[model samples]
Target: MSLAELLALVNDLSQSDKLSLFKLLAAQIPDAELQVIFSASEYPVWSPYDATEAANILMQMIEDDKEASTRA
Candidate 1:
């Protein structure tokens, strides 16, 4: 599905469903460490388990989306 289509669908999912989906994505890929890109002073701890783990999860999600779309 297109990004616009995906966004529309994602917007309709329940909070619990979203959380469950996130946990499932995390289980598939090990958590990735992320460093703050703006400053060099201090790097904040980042993980797929963190609140924004959606960043990492989205990356995997996009790849999966591509494959699924291709198959369709």
Candidate 2:
């Protein structure tokens, strides 16, 4: 659907439903960017553990955003 249609539907939703939709959308976007602290001749390091940790952090950020939005 178009953005206009989406906004129209969102306008019809109750506050709780709108909040839920906001959470879903927020979870799909990351709130931060990882900076690569690399030295000359060295590449940014990444491991399975780092990937898992990043995912957890992103989820936590999304939850935090949701909570903050609810308070507004």
Candidate 3:
């Protein structure tokens, strides 16, 4: 299923059901990996762009950062 469809299903879940689902998924990852994922820099709230547009925006940001790092 596409991410949008998966997100739609998740949005329809009850609070307890969401927690259960989160636990189920989280259990599959090792503690160390989860810690690294959680510790990564938090992304800003998404702007009102479609998924494709948002992905392009992020790609540009990544490339800009790469260019800046190369200059430094």
Candidate 4:
């Protein structure tokens, strides 16, 4: 059957059946192909911990703004 027809049939499947279909399809794929499809990479994440410099800069900006407002 065409992919569109197969997808339509798959759409009608229950959640458990869909999960089974996913496992079956994944089993057919080679390890290398799966690795390529799901590449591992590190991503930088921002944390508030050890952010004293940023906090100081923000406080300075606030102070500058307050000083400017008082002068106005």
Candidate 5:
């Protein structure tokens, strides 16, 4: 489902239900899987795990962009 629809559904829920729903959602999203997603995306995706190795890659990209912008 889309974010707008999801938000609407969340808002329709009671506070207790909302927390439970959030916990359920959170449980489905594993950190290892999230790390993989962050690493593979073209855009910068932050990760807590060293497994993704995105920090070095993203930082280098950011550095390159900054240098390019300064040169321009």
Candidate 6:
């Protein structure tokens, strides 16, 4: 059967059966593959909180543009 047909059948399974099937499939994956799929790495996330320097620079640029437009 095609993957779509298999997925459709799997969709009909109960929650417990789905979990069992997932465990069975996950067990067949190699250790390296599993590690890559579930990586243990910290990723940096950017936040605008306490970004005063960047906000000041952006405000200066806007002011400069306004001044230049008035001069033109």
> Best candidate, TM-score-wise?
4
Put down candidate 3 lDDT per residue, 1-72, tens digits, no spaces: 999999999999999999999999989999999889889997799666568977898999999999999999
Q: Where does candidate 1 stray beyond 4 Å?
A: 31-72
Span of 10 residues, lowest total lDDT, candidate 3: 46-55
- State, as a TM-score between 0 and 1, how close model 4 is to the true structure: 0.60
After superposition, the stretches of candidate 6 with alpha carbons farther than 4 Å from their true spots are 40-42, 47-72
RMSD of 5: 12.0
Cα displacement (Å) at residue 21, model 4:
1.3
1 against 4, candidate with superior TM-score: 4
Q: Which stretch of 10 consecutive residues in model 2 shows the poorest summed lDDT? A: 31-40
Clash pairs, model 5 backbone: none
| Candidate 5: tens digits of C-alpha lDDT, residues 1-72 | 999998998899999999999899889999999788789847688668775566788888999999999999
| Candidate closer to the true structure by TM-score (higher is better), 2 or 4 | 4
Across residues 17-69, which tens digit of lDDT does each residue of candidate 6 receive?
99999999989999999889788788999999999999999999999999999
Error of 3 at 49 (Å): 39
Backbone clash numbers for all candidates listed: 0, 0, 0, 0, 0, 0
The lDDT ranking, best first, is 6, 4, 3, 5, 2, 1
Looking at model 2, the pairs that clash are none
For candidate 3, the per-residue lDDT at 62 reads: 100
- Looking at model 5, residue 70 earns an lDDT score of 100
Per residue, candidate 2 scores C-alpha lDDT tens digits across 4-72 of 999999999999999999889867765452132232366678676758878998999999999999999
Q: Which structure is stronger by TM-score: 3 or 5?
A: 3
- Residue 38: error of model 1 in Å? 15
Per-residue CA lDDT of model 1 for 41-63, tens digit only, reads: 86688665655767778889999
Ranked by lDDT, the better of candidates 1 and 6 is 6
Candidate 3 shows a clash count of 0
